[model samples]
Target: MMKIEGTLYPWRFRLVLALLALMVAAIAIRIVDLHVFDHDFLQGQGDARSVRHISIHAHRGLITDRNGEPLAVSTPVTTLWGNPKELQGARAQWAALAKALNQDPKVLTERLEQQAGREFTYLARGLTPEEGQAVLDLKIPGVYGLEEFRRFYPAGEVTAHVIGFTDIDDRGREGVELAFDEWLAGVPGRRQVLKDRRGRLIKDVQVVQNAKAGKALALSIDLRLQYLAHRELRNAITEFGAKAGSLVLLDVKTGEILAMVNQPTYNPNNKRNLEPAAMRNRALIDVFEPGSTMKPLSMSAALETGRWKPEDRVEVAPGTLRIGRYTIRDVSRTEGGVLDLTGILIKSSNVGMSKVAFDIGGESIYSMMQRLGIGQDTGLGFPGERVGNLPNHREWHKAETATLSYGYGLSTTAVQLAHAYATLANDGRSVPLVMTRQDNVPEGAQVISEKVAKTIQGMLQQVVEAPGGVFRAKVPGYHVAGKSGTARKTSVGSKGYKEKSYRSLFAGFGPSSNPRIAMAVVIDEPTNGAYYGGLVSAPVFGKVMAGALRLMNVAPDNLPPPEETKAAVAGESSKPGKGDRT
Candidate 1:
């Protein structure tokens, strides 16, 4: 068999040749596919192995108050980055980076060593120019820096709540910043970079996307007025040892917020130390029982319905009135024996006012309040505005009706009270309160008859100028009409009012004969002996109103001297049965 195999068959030899040919063709086909079919893909793979990329930041926009005063802005800074693969000795490089960045060497080492294969890592952010120069001088192979921007607030704490603050990435976090983030944060740009053999950026290939700077935002807040209100409120908080306070000034005709200040305001610059209470904008966010200040609304409703006259007499027995389990007592403790509608307002009598509210009925009183914008937001565009709490007429019990009549068992924001009082000054028209100026003035709804509004206005004047009334708030030369409110603050943990803690409030319009500005001042827990609104809050109202009135150049209603007006009031009072209007 071996001897025969020596002379091989022709067919077997042909098969061996065919197998060899197939192997050669397979190798040739692989070579052609690699060189021709995947030419672009191979080229791209090679380029990718040699090049690296990084991101760049764009500049943010400016924030200004209504008067073009800078409130929030951004400044250029440098962010230090490092490439771990390029760092030969991690420990040594981290020490050098720590010294340059003023950070812990251990922390830098951990950050650099944790991601050893990464091409990029942020070492420090928001470095000053000098610090960035120091890092650049080191000429470390792995270390690099990029120019970026960080937020800055020029007005600091003064405009903190209005202008708000931004985050580490220069993005708005609150207030106007959060409200207009899209318009304030500019579009980011992109750059293409080329890397060398050592995995370091050799040059910028090109700018892939051009950055568009953010649009400047102009707010409705007036910086000067903001500063003034801030200073005054801070002073009130300090001088009176008040727990907190707020002052709001409004343009009666335009409904623009001239000034709004809340005490204990925080500085957005040092936001890490901010407290929950300091961040609250009390004027817009807080609501409370308005106390005697709401009495005017009740009386106004009664007069509007033709159910009562200013001179009509109502018997107010003793100083207290028992309704259900609650007893309402007068602050002065004087028995308001026989008081007219005007006398009830002057004395702030709970019994007499309750009579008037009972006559108007719950439905009419609630309807009138709704029309006057009570229990509603004032449309001031402030974030977190409270509409206040007012129970429906059907929900009111016997005691609820009488207590609500004298401004209790209901809550209202300071702005709402000012807006409602403004309606009384604006000839019974309740215009929408606005924070910004509009191209066209918004027409208001008629909440009361003009005659009824005038009667209430006349009665409110007596609340400020009558003999037994708390009228020390009246300015010497200005005809002021407003009501005082001294309400015990409700405790958070208890149903009873806080001891020795009161919220003193005053809402008034200056030059009452032709009102221009309507203002409200609320002092929380004033420690000074004077806890009455007419005594504590009214003085602040007078001061702010005097400045605002003079700023507007409004003519004084009492052109005569201060002494002459007192003499006139005294002379008029000497005549029996002769009533004096404020």
Candidate 2:
């Protein structure tokens, strides 16, 4: 057997053992220091790389009509974001991520390049839950999504002018949304969380601040009435081939706007194609000469001076009058021989109106206008609401005064006209117009004597009830009172007025005796050869009024139904011809 013998040195063996012991002691010391003395510091350094603070979104308030119908609401959404620096490192995943985001890869690369130093960038904001989840499923590095709220408008263009819409972050942008943004948008919250290297949330670390939900707002608008107004106004604008139109319906007793709608409105839900013109609330913002509708107010001013009575007479034989170089002419060339106050309204005699207003003087006219809330804040607090233009009485020339009597040299919004007519309908009491439902009736300021208001109301009723009246505005089973106006659009750059362009308007209320609602309809630049308010605007008023009265269950004031009038017409034919009578 071969035996192996080792010639080993005792000193070398002892040196190896000594080195092993030193290494073991050093390792033991390091373990104790790391576990006991520097544990918190080291742990904090590790967490700093993976832990992040995040925002918790809070939803905006809801906007509903008086009957609790939602006009505007918010829906849960997500915002996809990413660290551009980290995302740039994952070039191989860029094409897939771009496809997921529905963006071009080149565009994504350029965007990241543009934000080279940015640690964070938005890939997409206000994405739906499904869209965001589709992106998250890819699990690309540095890509992440956070909860958010996106505004949604259900009423679209129908209530766009009233309810408005919000921004990407759910901030109110227009209409009632902007008007009451603070009341609608609430505060956001914060949270701390642990995130994996791929930007996925692993666990919630701490809640920094709890979010407070926004309060809901209830408007005075009746969605049903609003829808009706929208449909009718849109139909009118299209039918007349008009540039734009507005309609306002008010509760005369309450001074609350039941419905306000404008044509040429845009869909608030999709704002990418928004135009500045479509965004305008024309009912509150646009103004024009009110034409013959002003005659009632002028007549009221004349009566206030005790210079005129409901039975008063004025000669309008010529149908044309000269106030300086301006030749004031009536719509009809045929002379209205003589007209009492009621006759003047029924005939819509511009000659008679000029005579009455000039006789009343400018101060009385201005006072009546001020009292009627013309050229004044509507108390709606709406953004971009114009007070319109009413020249100070002190600035009135003879020509201007004559023009003012017939609704020229002055401008007013549709809402202003509606409010003024509402005052007359409510027995000469003027109250602040409201857009929100009110629990208590607002105090009313008297603008005219109830006797005078009643008299004017009778005259207006005559305009619809008399043979040569605004028959187009008459409503069946209801005593309707209204005024029609056709004003030429003033030329933009210079000179007199546009030849054929006209603003057709109608303003009134019903049932005339116990007025429940007052409304105004204005159609701009009607081009379908029906430019007169009696022809273009009055029909809309009648249709809307008839439908609204029925919807509100208002008692019918007329003895016979309008449909019964067809039988009356048939009976007339059966009675006799001129030859048979002879």
Q: TM-scores across all candidates?
A: 0.84, 0.87
Q: Please list the residue runs of candidate 1 whose C-alpha ends up more than 4 Å from where it truly belongs after superposition.
A: 1-56, 85-90, 115-120, 196-199, 333-336, 393-395, 437-440, 561-582
Cα lDDT, all candidates: 0.79, 0.88
Clashes of 2: 0
Give candidate 2 misplaced runs (Cα > 4 Å). Answer: 1-52, 194-202, 333-336, 561-582
Worst 10 residues of 2 by lDDT: 1-10
Overall local distance difference test of candidate 2 = 0.88
Model 2 lDDT per residue over 97-216, tens place: 989898999999889889877778999998899999999999888788888998888888899999888877788878898999999888888898998775667999899899888889
**Residue 390 alpha-carbon offset, candidate 2, angstroms:** 0.9
